[model samples]
Target: MSVAELRPNMDFWQERVDMAAAFRWTERLNMHEGVANHFSLAVNDDGTQFLMNPNQMHFRRIKASDLLFLDANNPKTLEGPDAPDPTAWGLHGSIHRRCPHARCVMHVHSTHATVLAALADSTLPPIDQNTATFYNRYVVDNQFGGLAFEEEGERCASMMSDPKVKTMIMGNHGVLVIGSSVADTFNRLYYFERAAETYIRALQTGQPLRVLSDEIAEKTAQELEDYPEQDVRHLNELKAILDEEGSNYAS
Candidate 1:
């Protein structure tokens, strides 16, 4: 089919479908804050364009086709038909402009992750095997100066200097995770949330915690390098759960 006759490319459609599924799945995990939070991915090799949900669209109400194809380099992007939320624009647009390595970016205020973010010291403890995935793979930006203004995106971009570090505790805001694709980012986010929840729960118990030794944690982190498709499998399992429950975010 011709470009005018046919729909967008398969890659574009797949990004929409996969991201919508992620939003729905995150909602079920109680990671959504009504209509807040945003996830985006670059549409092409260049970081000029991206795909993200429109403003005010709740996660449960989001569909693949509802996503807006936003051009970060466009002068009139904020005035477009499906304009993005201000914070989304401020944060995502900045990263896309400055951070070429982040193909996909997901920001959320999940319960445990947000709680951890508010802590005076925003470091994830290597207390368990799950937490080890982020061993020496995160950056804690201590400067929380109100909402993420337009200028703030560039600052966040600067802090994300390492491509290998997928996780970023956005000061007092929340958590941001990036990956080469939506599936990879979502998988990391899910595991990161789990790790945060585990540590927070242990803190609540008021008992002595069993923290992993640095040598063991470092070894586990290295072993995790072999699981290149770990995120793919984890996402498939979540999709299966949605299928069993009749949530048609993919459809």
Candidate 2:
């Protein structure tokens, strides 16, 4: 059968496709960390139920049908045949269960973001438009209490309690971002990495930095947030490119 013919007509099919495309594109951007990181999307009204990538799967190879549907409240989730990675279950489950507003969660150990996270100040200054986009919008988790098991996950989720904070600079760890959808979250993740790269490269130059004023930074952030359909268009164009290349992500 053709890939389209075998596609499942289940709930959240489009969400799965979008998420798979995000995964593929993330890999293409060299943002994925081997088979370690994860992405999840809430599938239920309360966000307790969600979909996640299968355990240890590489982003480039993940198809829409390969996602695992999970319930954060279910204790037996980790014991199933298609069980997710423990850290994924712990981190994503905590977010989905505690933060209903965070409909989608993406975690990565991308190079620049992780470097920023490792810094003593883990702060992204408003150096330029890209960096300014995240001004005062991210929370820095200074406490790195090992891997994201249940307790660690709970602590991380606690920091995201503020409705306005959509990104977390996981201190000594990686980065985590949440949004209303896959496109929005992935877009944030992509830009955050780009912003981090810019900041890091600037720091390496040893030259005096030209930082934006707080007022202008906030204004830029707000303007970028309100930009029309950029996130949707970004993901659509990526999916179109994948389709043209005969990628199986949507399958």
Candidate 3:
């Protein structure tokens, strides 16, 4: 559809469709682990109000209309019939509530990323171009207090407040990536897994890793940041594929 075709009133619907598409695409890419992980996008500027997947819903079957709206400060979310997963509410909700820059949050336990997270040293070494994409721009939260219950979730969200850091390797847990938009966040999540895979493979080689210098790594990261608009195209193409595949994600 052309830009002119998107009515101003349909902004919320469009964002929902885009977010649902991200969920389906993540499933297709094998990044989803059953119904375990969560993805959320803020609907309001303050980030306190957001959309998240309902509890126990598989990512592959998530519909645009199935997402639940939540307020970070609403403690009643945990007691309702339509309540979200506690951990999801805790982690995604708290981040959305506290970090205005984190408009989109994608948390996953994809194999490679989780593997890296499991390591004592969970930092992604700048050993390749993909790794360099996150060099000096990622943070590590080495505290793992099990599930992100209310307080634990707040702690995790606090670790993600730095706008300069888009990716957070949740030590002994999984990975959390945030962005100002769903497409950007999903794109980062996609590439992060690939980078983690490559890093793990290189480590398996048992050879001394040829790490990049700080100057080069910083330059490459800046270059990657400059090309942020490509994520929209990437997401659009994925949506096009879903359109052809008779997806019910937007239903």
Write down the lDDT of every candidate, Cα atoms only.
0.84, 0.94, 0.90
66-139: candidate 2 lDDT, tens digit per residue = 99999999999999899999999999999999999999999999999999999999999999999999999999
Please give the TM-score that candidate 2 achieves against the real structure.
0.97
Question: What's the lDDT for residue 247 in model 3?
Answer: 87
Query: lDDT ranking from best to worst?
Result: 2, 3, 1
At residue 157, candidate 1 shows an lDDT of 79
Better of 2 and 3 by lDDT: 2
**Top candidate by lDDT:** 2
What lDDT would candidate 3 get against the real structure? 0.90
User: Against the true structure, whose TM-score is highest?
Assistant: 2
lDDT of 3 by residue, 98-177 (tens): 89999999999999999999998899989998999999889998889999887998898888777999999999888999
> Which 10 consecutive residues of model 1 have the lowest summed lDDT?
1-10
Query: How does model 2 fare in lDDT?
Result: 0.94
Clashing pairs in 3: none
